[model samples]
Target: MSSNVAGRVVCYSVLSPPRRSRREQIISQLLTSVGSLREHNRTVRVVVFWLGSRHQETEDRLRSLEAQVVHLGSYEDLLHPFPGGDVLVRYPVLHKYFVLDAVLEDLGTSQLLLIDCDTVFLDDVDKLFERHADVDLAACAEVGTVRRERGYDPAYLDEEHLARLAQSLGGRFVEPINSGILLLSRKGIEELAKLRPALLEITLRLMVGLAKSAEESDFAPLVQLRERLASGAPEVKGVAPLGFPSSNHWIVEEVALWLALGLTESLTMRDLPPSDAALGGEVYRRPRSASSWIIGHYFSVDTAPAMSWCRTGQPPHASPKGRSRAADELPIDPALAASPLLVEHEGFALYEDLFGLDVLSEMTREAREAYWGGQEQSLTARFGGVGRDSHPPRRLVSAGGGDVQDAAYCSPSLKAFLESLCGLEVEPTGRRGSVNYYTRSGDFMGLHLDVVQCELVVLTVLQDLSPADDPSGSWELFPGQVGRPLPSVSTGRRDRRSIKAMPGQSLVMFGGLVPHRVRPVAAGQRRIVSALCFRAGQTALEPPTVPQD
Candidate 1:
């Protein structure tokens, strides 16, 4: 069957019925998730369903993006006082349970990528199918330690009850998992329709039980309760809290899925990597480190300034980097504007058009032609050559032949430009430059600093075209982490930036001082990069000194 016959879908819910405020706020978030769709090879239909009266602007925006808007009546008409309906209106998060079954029915045999509204996708959502097609249920496991003692955790899921529910269903125990980002096949979804009555009962009972046992507190039902549970820390001490997993019931729908799974004899499940579908505070706090994460469940986060590309029938612009910003133009310094377009900061500047498109296009063509496709370099943990302090294997095919370097690396004008950026004269180091190929699927580079010889690191993504559905091989730069441990780059690196440099762009970083690595290359992706190193001295005459790695 052709893709035109039927396509897959990604689903999200937003600002519930009668709440017409925060229009642009939701639009930005919608763009964040919608913008991420460009990374996917197969076109995914965006379906926004809600128990609501539609906001005209949001509908118009969705129409402009060619998204299909599915409005399932109003809260007063569809789900008045039905079982679990009380919590559904009170907690907007639980609304998915009401809409997903219908979505699955329409999808028939195809699957659905059910995600939160505030999520930002990093790679393709189709990866869930590639990795977890065999499983009936797959979800991103809650990051960090699982506080079993708390019984009900961050997702407001009653893990203890869920464990017993799973045990009662099929003697299989499920951990505390976030259902905000979930994958569902029609096979399992079919069972959900048949079990809808029982599922609602289970949801009602769970909500009542958690609420009865919940401690007394004063948090405005939706906003205050959700914000605090998501960002704040209060004591649970084993007993249930007031709003968490109880009255608010953000995770009740996830719990309903667990209940429904028990009735089905063909239940199978897997946990997706947190690096791929991160949730909560991690989405906004450390986007650079979590940049490779394709889907971010940004529940209540509004400070996601570094918005990804939002290409829905429109050009990839919208952020400072992505085509459009607030005014569509940044405050340009007259002198800086006259030079090459760049996003400059203290020690970092992302040159949007370092080498003009035509020149770099030719350079990229030359580098690809010059590649000898040498032996596959094993940079994996098993392919150990560097000392004990070496990074996770830099597994990939590399050709460091001088021809390839000379073909693209040694540009006289480029070096002169670099001299200005570095504030000193520069010369190619012994490792002048090398073409690294992320040949096979799953190939990656662990976090590590460049060798001592690398003083000025210049890297350009010659060709990042990948046939893989989940192609997320981007350059993650850790400018803020110089002296820190190699693996420490993923967490809390304030200045870390995950960059997927286009063919025309180039980056100049003090590689020896900044720790960095490449995210794993997905299947059908051939990631080729041209990395060149240079040396700089205190004065133009003295031998250049290397920064300690």
Candidate 2:
């Protein structure tokens, strides 16, 4: 299939069985993004690659859309068959490879642009073709999603794995780009295919044994890098990855606009208008444009350990509404502020004046209850409620756990809060950050600070009104000069701090020098607050107060 029209290019990708609610949201985003192309009549073709026994409902929906739909038969025919889980993890990479192979070989189209399903096309991306034709491949430069020791540490992977990734990337980290979005020329797609065999070998090997999470996909680029290193090639000599100077780093769609800003990094608040009403608080009409609003790390939040690869917090839907503190009512006594304010090591300043304090309070209260309430006492009982030694309540906290930990998962309020803070509704990095819970008896998490990978934490305490013994329940740190606990919060402890967080009161700790521990609960009944930790840089703004007439 040859492109008779000069402007024709294939735009393709895939989506498999997703949670019902998520499926709707992603579908809406996909249609919204692609709808932009319709104005140009640019003949945009979308290919959705799905695996497993086909779901006619899903296929029908895709077919209903004007775009093309390709069901790649069974997952087995696609590659060394991995479980549905493994398949889902590598689905994007595989889908791109399949689409490029099909589009180029079957349609004979050389030019292609691959956009992830989640993207929303605010403007014509056709310019991507115009700009990138000069380079063999063009992609948004690698935004450091997860912090890596302030420099190119590259410590996550060993030599063998790194070498494999560099090799698979075809001695070029340029093409196959972010896979979230990219523009690939015919040669680029062909080169991607050429590297498929080695890439698949590594993918299968990792999926079966080595890979722990989606990080396996990095192997493609690592293999390519290894090849270059083995040949003693200079880093700059290989294919180049395009850098968009003006862009905010996180996963959200705003990165596209940042790239649109181009050369001018120094953006005043006024330069970049609020992306939406939700962002108005954190961003404003600055007189000048500095480099502030553009960069990946600035907007990142902590998530699960495996997700440490990117800073975006857990998937947008997973975050809970963490507590909010009002700047007007200083948590620390202003009289005590004779010198620079002292907070925990990771602590950072939070403003409640610009963003409203009430909205956050209401939302946090509701979220605290909804999350904990949704889980059956039976389930909480499964972990041993207060002091049942028979079950021996494990301190296990994970994405699936529904305690305050659910805050790691964003709720609508949480998303609005973050959008206000970051000035955009950034995408959530698919990482699950840590959440800690302490129960009576066998249910205690010993004193500990989060790992480097853990960015920020919001601690919210929810306990029964009735209390007993140990007078424990207070957040503790190494005893100060008086040998009593001192609690100044920071990241991993950010958010407002509140003692006696009975039914509604909660605390949030941002970055700082604070180390904290929960006091023990009485034997009769135990108290618990769902403690949630997020990837760093992914912070939120309180909602503005609505003035009454």
Candidate 3:
């Protein structure tokens, strides 16, 4: 009954065996999760429920891990109320709820923590128990859904059926919760037991209705359900008036739990702040500085490589062999080391006048003139040999194939300087440099990581014609941070750190690892920049051609 008991009890379920590779993946995840949990909480007790036929290797592994394994028997009697044939056999997720029910029936513990096997503890979770001590159930809100939007749509729900279900619960449905990481007390379990029958009935009805409706409509049942949920329905019975469609095969348990909590008068549900617990891909991409993150669910197959590397401290290769380039080997220049622009932890540097002012000025002038002349000639030819009255400038051009600016950027002295500063031997890629000429307002580059061949990128500002007070051109960098995913063009701009680069200044970054972008240019502004790409350990006179821009 004490909070200590709750902190000690950690429960998880593995229902069926997947493919050989997936099985191995699950085993690895369990080992890492249990190992990490034991390291941080010596008194932690792990309980795993096996729902189907016995997997000897898995059972032995769990035993070796000092985990108590419970094999669940036939749930025919409990699932009989649901019209579906062998619901337990058909859907493995149902096993999680049944496992909890079995545990409550047998164990004397008043509180328990339910975690998915795909998750690992990052920090001590004692605070989580204390934080939700007063609540009957607590879980993280599901991302990419209306759960956090505080409103629900009705198109996905069988409105009349949902209205009937709400009448039975004496309340309405609320925002759905993710059950990946959950905390449940004795009272909460009891509430779920009372509501389980109605939950099953409603889910069965919804599933049948959607299946029947799908035969007549073009949309899938799940899609129709989601569409209906997105409709902003009025709140009813002190809960958000939302309904769960059973067509959502994977999230039935979560839907049932949400309904139980909202329908039960004595039960309470609390949203676990995202900062405290992250699920799926969000876990791998959580910021390293997020010390408050207690549980992380690396559930997605996309995160398998990262999870393997994080757990084993090695590359996820069959041969298990690889080389690493240590950052310490790169010595920093004492004079430039203390500059704020040099982010030592992120392997980047920003320098003013990296290229001499005179060189930059001459290159900028010539490039601008060449571009303008080319435009004028094109215009004159287009107008039947008559010189055009005025000519607009081209916004962008590839400054490659032996351009003067390209030659300046690839100078021997500059290459040597960069090599010394970063302690890495490098050579320029054969790809032509990009001459971005932003002449119009709102011209912007989205955040993105450079191609793999571009180990390093040297971006030099050739010209900025914006007003001195309203300089619109700036470099935004998403530095390489631990426990964070590589930022992408789709990510919000707020996550980036912007730096204004004056003409002649250069920004050096690990192009393939760090995500960087250029801010929009304002009206009446003319900004010109050059991007030079480099590869590691290649000194050949000619390099393979690759797109750099």
- Top model number, lDDT: 3
In order, candidate lDDTs are: 0.53, 0.35, 0.55
lDDT of 1: 0.53
Name the 10 consecutive residues with the lowest summed lDDT in model 1: 309-318
Each prediction's RMSD over C-alphas, in Å, is 19.8, 17.4, 19.0
**Residue 257 shift from truth in candidate 3, angstroms:** 2.9
- Best candidate, TM-score-wise? 3
Error of 3 at 410 (Å): 41
lDDT of 2 by residue, 1-549 (tens): 334355346464544433332343344444544553554444555556555445566556555655566666654466545323233343324545555666666455656766655343323445445545654455443322221112222221122333344444344221111344555666666666665544444343333322222121112233343344457555223323322211111111222222222222222211111121101111111211321321111110111111221123222112124523222221322212221223222232233232234533543444333322121111111211111011221232221223233334455565455434433322222222222333333233333333321223444444443443244455544312111112222324333242444434444433222344455444433444544443333221222111100
| lDDT tens readout by residue for model 1, 229-296 | 45543421222322223222334555665665566667566776765666554454342542566666
* Model 1 regions more than 4 Å off: 1-7, 15-24, 39-42, 84-88, 107-109, 143-172, 219-249, 284-290, 302-549
lDDT of 3 by residue, 1-549 (tens): 123344347888775543333345556677678776766666666788765557788778777777788877545544655544242233345556666566666456666788777777767766677777788888877643445442333322233443455566677756567777878777876676667665664454444444334222112233443344345322111222234453223444555555555675787878888667766544544334533477777653324434644545433322213422222222222433332334464646778877777777777765564332111000001101001111122122332222566666678987888777766566777534545555445555644445434657788877786655564777677663321323213345565667787677788876555556567777666676777777643322335433231
TM-scores for all candidates? 0.46, 0.42, 0.49
What TM-score, to 2 decimals, does candidate 2 have?
Answer: 0.42
| Shift of residue 201 alpha carbon in model 1, Å | 2.2
Please give the range of 10 consecutive residues that has the lowest summed lDDT in model 2: 276-285
